[model samples]
Target: MSLTGHLAASLHDRGLGGDQASAARALRAVHRAMAELRRGTPVLIRGGDHTLIIAAAETVSARGLSELGLAGIGPAVLLLAPVRAAAVLQRPVPQDAPGTEAGAVALRLPPALLDPAVLRSLADPTAERLLPAEPERVGAPALASAAIALAKLARLLPALVAAPAAEAASGRLDLLSVEAGHIAAYPDTAAGTLTRVAEARVPLEDAPEARLVAFRAADGGIEHLAILVGQPEQALAEGSVPLARIHSECFTGDLLGSLRCDCGPQLRGAIKRMAEDPSGGVLLYLAQEGRGIGLVNKLRAYALQDQGLDTLDANRALGYGADERNFWVAAEMLRAVGIGRVRLLTNNPDKLAGLAACGIGVEGREAHQFAANGVNDAYLQTKARRFGHLLT
Candidate 1:
């Protein structure tokens, strides 16, 4: 019951080839795929750069998707955005049509998905509104809405290119825009109607501290990440400048200390370190469980792992490859606290890569490993070997 089994089970439930399959099975397939990526379960995609995957995902609409078939359109529509990039020529796409890259990226959608109606629902405004919202939302209408959203984003890309300069000029959050190249505001920072810049960093005492404290993410979900702060001011220059234990939500390891993984100790260790450090680091416990995949699907992957699937195989078995987490909110928390450079504490190199790419720097990275036990040895080895963790 590796990830593939999970997916086959899900497809079985879809009535795609089912009389015995259940809808929950399909949901788990979607779940494992997303969480695998988010949690840094490593695997390569189509031999291209990771940004291509991210760029495609970014270009798609994030709203309203229940059916795996309907939501699958996002990645499909997203593949077009990177073609305009200069690097795309450096890494030319294969002889595939626009949406085909998305299909190749996430091979869940049928090849018939190349239909113009699917493309139109994604692009046509009227069809987008007509996109089925409830029961009828699974097929063409969902694809239609994705098509429209992607088209809208594409239309807005040029303007979006200039949005950073405008956003930083008028943020009340304690964020500094020193580097001209990366001056975008925090993803959660309020925009619109205001266009003023901060002269300098505003901390406690003379100036007011924004309520960034209230945004802590404490949860019982699947993925877990921790943000430890040795020095906050070096990274960002925002109001209240929060140091955080940024954990992705994980259901099994964090709560149950599942031997299949070591997420629990890392999370607790993050809290302990943050609490001890005294830099006022906020533990932003995330609700994006199983890397936003939810609980049941993780169990499904476990079942697959028992069936001798490697991590990536587990996800692919479930019908997805690795990685699906977004760091906008994590970036926001850093911005809210006025941190410019961070002394990040983690073993995962991709976290460093992703955060740095998103505009945060690892001025330093420290490794964190909980006590090793009999249960999670293979799991830790898998994470360390395949995903590139700095094992201790």
Candidate 2:
């Protein structure tokens, strides 16, 4: 039988649906591959008619690169997102360029650029001094694009060192193998598998009556939190839309009280507002640090900010989108807790539209603006001007 038919038959033998089970298995493989990538270990990606061994450019060491080279048949290559490739090559790569996602600019890696430091400089735009090299742009294997995607999922820089794998390298080298198609399908597949796993009454300073619900995907990845304050479920039961806020977790701002942005104030202030509201509210604290580029990359962006690049531009320069937080996870969490309609507490118009697109009924919006401290005035202005936040 065909691959699809075989997968369906195996899932049926285990009493599971074909699509969901296949996606779950694929997500688990991708999850393990991400861990391997983060630890600087090379992973073998198997696509149709091709096999490649790839390592994260951010974490891979000289030893790891050498070992990857030893195991692979062809010359090693560096795969970079178009934006980052542009920065490294000092050329223009239009965002609207066709085939951007389908392929990446593969720079043939020379012996001098194989060091960890040089690889990092090529991946990171905020590097102090980029090493000079004659980079030849070539169309990388289709799997190279997915390899970069895997690095992004690991919260690393969207750059990877890849080489064509030796024959039967998966068995000979004992490398973790992941399908490129699975890496491509990871986001939606993981989001679709988000289930409310655990919850408890976690009282907060502002919201005394609060319960924290945790949602985890089937692959056992990061959990998104739902802070139900002042009986939001009850409000939903009574046909009153609860106040809702989708807060992306900011490590520096929320925990360390860093004044780089208004995240701490917004997080605390949103809870207080919900507690005071008679209709109650739910706060979805998504584990999307640095607007989904992860914490370390966020620090890199902070370094870029010191050089006068705004928040959005810094992220783009780092080969990431302006905001990579997926609100589909938020919508799934809300649905699990029986909340389909909400009066969202946010200044960003994107939140309103994001929920609406995910089939969540946004009854209205409540402004949850916080006054800018002296340090965050310019940052707040960037939010309003560049991110189109509705700040008054």
What does candidate 1 score on TM? Answer: 0.46
Q: Whose lDDT is greatest here?
A: 2
Q: How many backbone clashes does candidate 2 have?
A: 0
lDDT of 2 by residue, 280-389 (tens): 99999999899889999999999999999889888878888678777778888999998999999999887887777777899999998888889989899999998888
Which candidate number maximizes TM-score?
2
Candidate 1 lDDT, 1-392, residue by residue in tens: 23234333333332322322322333233333233323322111111111111211212222211112231224232222222211222344342433232322112223443333453333222223222232110112112222212222122221000000122221322221121111111111111101112223224221122122434321111322223334445323443333444577676777766777778787766656654553545455555555533455456567767878666445433333354344555655555555555656678766665556546555667678776698778877877887777885
Candidate 2 at 238: error in angstroms?
1.5
* Candidate 2 pairs with clashing backbones: none
Off by over 4 Å in 2: 1-20, 95-103
* Every candidate's lDDT: 0.38, 0.82
Q: RMSDs, each prediction?
A: 18.4, 5.8
